[model samples]
Target: MVAVRTARTLGLALALCFFSGAFAGVGTAQEKKAEKAKSKLKISVPQDDAELQIEGKATKPTGTVREFETPDLEVNKAYEYTFSVTWRPNNYTTLTRTKSVEFKGGTADINVDLTKADPKAPDKAVIRWVPTPDDVVEEMLKLGSVKEGDVVYEPGPGDARMLIAAVKKGAKKGVGIEIDAKKAAEATENVKKAKLDEKIKIIEGDALKQGDYSEATVVLLYMGNEFNALLRPILEKQLKPGTRIVSHRFTMGDWAPDKTVPVKGADGDEYMLHLWTVKEKK
Candidate 1:
């Protein structure tokens, strides 16, 4: 009986040891996973009160800089960090800027200075309000085959000439997005004057940040090369297959147009119009 009791106690001890070893192994794996899931980000701003958003979530700033840990990220996989900063330097003016960066699972730092103007940044003033002549606008619409059942979108539509003409040409709806507040208001007024207010809508906002253009069957552009390039990715990503993009006087970088045509403007000068159709994804 004594020998049997000793054997049973030994067996219990071995079983407890085995279970404890298994639990320890699991704990080590969990620790390693937690380490891989976190990344560090530090951002410096020009002002303490400047509002900042990291990955679309507002992050509080401490003094001129803020450091925080990001949420779970895949190990060694790069992720795009999209952030925006907004601040006011004076009572009359407010400024907002958005930028993006890519980061893997590691530490990253960025500096955003709103006090100094970015020389490379595309300016609305630089684009110049060159309205497509009435006849040229007609040709552009015709090139895109704008007609009934089509929804047309024009970005930076200075006075909304393109949208106005498109609606008059038989488009189901026309949408204009202008970055300049004054331009947007003027466009709205023009739409009302044309008595197409019900068919056209003018939005006052940055085209890049507006984020939705899937409803548009046709797009009209009269912006410069820089502006067109800036908008290229958004158009490619958001526009649906077979959507037609028509541009006057400029082209997106290296993206060959499906067709190009020259038309004489009412001003007596010849202008070029380019058209592209979004192809189905492979």
Candidate 2:
């Protein structure tokens, strides 16, 4: 009886071990299945960079992974937005995507997917300040009549960046500037030597509003054709008959000028320099 009881006990122990092993194996399989279901798409960007904005239906699903990369990453400035995306279950790997856009300044949107796919190129967008519609008309008129020795109308000194670029590209450029005592002290040595710091008077008020073109042989208009249209009547009456007006990257609107010259800007923007000499009096 003792030997029979021992054999039975051993059999029960063996049965328990087999069942436990089977259940343990099944539990691991289920856990892996759950993990596969939880896998998701990942989006990444660089730290300390500008915010990545999402619009439209993309904004939903707040739990989606967000990534960052900075403009500094692309030293070449070839791409405005760049990021890597991937997925779990080996469905995807780090994929690089990019889009091209105009130079208009603002937060631009870029969309992506979990499949690690390439997106179409971004539409041509402007990153710079686009003059208003009315300004567009005005700019065309102003740019059409541009000639050498014209004071390019710019509101802020920062606007000089464009003119400086044009000058670097061989456009004869000059500006009437007025510097304050503080600025004069810190002026570049060349500027001081040229007396630009003292003689080029910086207008105390809005330079565009001051209506002071007395010393201007020409007014280089960059405001766009719409604004030029509004200025058509003003130029018709105020400007000297032989005075030259030049415009950049705009078309002449309703105002018919004396002459037009086609030219390319530093960035290759096509512009027509229109010449209007007091619309020769009838």
Candidate 3:
């Protein structure tokens, strides 16, 4: 998990497990005041050196009950979290666990016992893959109002065209999480070819699983409706208020978007784009 942000960003902070960076907020007074009282998470297992990494929020811990605190979180917001446990003595076979929770602003105890589920379970793809074109990416970023200081992330960044475009459009940084190993390599190469090797980071991992976009200001998506539906609760819980989400051709089941638009693709095909802003859960 190396980052253009800094090589040691993850090496030291996450012990070469996962690496990421953060951005400061300059927002309305209410938003500024909400940046305290983080959610509390504690993971319990038999291993004292169990490396625990959660989804969405980014602070990996190691201990019997790996305890950590999240950054200021939205109240009544549903977020998806993943617990990635690695027992080095066992040859580093990773056990990944995912859960969705609605936390009110404050220190909510999220105690997870990883012993319950099989630590070696595999994951299934949640969405059929579809790549977003560069022009369509431009439209989505514009639709989401991606600009300077924004950090963009695409969960299933196919070839990373979306992130490459975000960096070019003045976004400070971009991250792409691709589940396919070959595509992830292809994306890394593409970013390098774009000379955005430093600005864009790629991860070859499960997109429908635990991963953090906590630093993201704008998130772009191109999954199907059901996939969006499955990810909606987690998105709402994990993304800070005011963060913009734009999906290329699908909408969250009943969570109406703030705006929706259609853009004609270069191939004479039309695509539907839906934009949603994370709101505090009522």
Candidate 4:
């Protein structure tokens, strides 16, 4: 009887071990499956010396990484990351700006090429404040064929009227940079009064020195001929292909416009608008 009982007890212990091992294997497979469901983030930069920082109130980035993984992030959830990149483009300019990027799906790719990023040259802020009238704004948009979801940027946005108008005309977003503090403040107030604070953003900074409008799908300029000429090279290098730029009463030096038209303003003054679409560089 004792031997029979011993054999039965040994069989029960062996069965328990086998079942526990099978369950453990399933748990390991489940962990591996969970690992595969996490998302990934990748950032590409021109130089190894370049630095990229994702700026948020509680957010911190490790460094300029070629590959990053978001194992904790929920699947299919989109997250917006604003980055400040400081890099010397071929030892050119130490460019820095707060720019946004949307990360979704299983992977996110961010490419940083400052070949024409921000013209962060330590030059004096050349302020030639030329305000664009509402009629001129309308004409400029008409000339550029501004459409919905277009990003409009005005470098020397005097009072941000151009940006506000662009937003009103159905552009997705508008950004205005003004060198003068008073004008920037006024632009802010004007945007607030128009109830366009959500759609238009005004930056109190130098247009000549600050050059991160690379996101602009349509650039509206009211600068002088000389300023526009000086800014031509930077715009050419930075702006993406098929991007449209329109200037009031000025021209981009050697790079000729796709079309130039004369529009009479509500004030009865004729304005010369020049539109240029960025093309492949030779």
Name the TM-score of candidate 1: 0.58
CA deviation > 4 Å runs, candidate 1: 1-126
Model 4 weakest lDDT span, ten residues long: 15-24
Q: Would you list the clashing residue pairs of candidate 3?
A: 55-82, 78-237, 79-237
For candidate 4, lDDT tens digit of each residue in 1-282? 111111121121211111112101122343345532333345555456656553322222334444434333323445454445555533213444445555543444435333234444332325446567887889899888888999998887878888888888899899888877998899999999999998898898877657686898999987766567567767877898988999988787777888999888888888899999888878
Q: Which ten residues in a row have the lowest lDDT in candidate 3?
A: 2-11
User: What do the candidate models score in CA lDDT, each in turn?
Assistant: 0.71, 0.35, 0.68, 0.65
lDDT of 2 at 77: 20
* lDDT score for candidate 1 against the true structure: 0.71
Top-lDDT candidate index: 1
lDDT of 1 by residue, 1-282 (tens): 111111122121211111112101122344356544444556666578877765455654456666655544445555565556766544423456566655554444434443443544432222446777888888999999998889999888899889988888899899998878889999999999999999999998877677379998999998777677767878998899999999997899999999999988778899999999999988
Q: What lDDT tens digits, residue by residue, belong to model 2 across residues 96-130?
A: 22322221112233334322323352211111233
Query: What TM-score does prediction 3 earn?
Result: 0.56
Query: Tens-digit lDDT track for model 3 on 67-131?
Result: 65554444543444455554433331233444333344454687777655442444233443567
| Model 2 TM-score on a 0 to 1 scale | 0.34
- lDDT winner between candidates 1 and 3: 1
Arranged by lDDT, best first: 1, 3, 4, 2
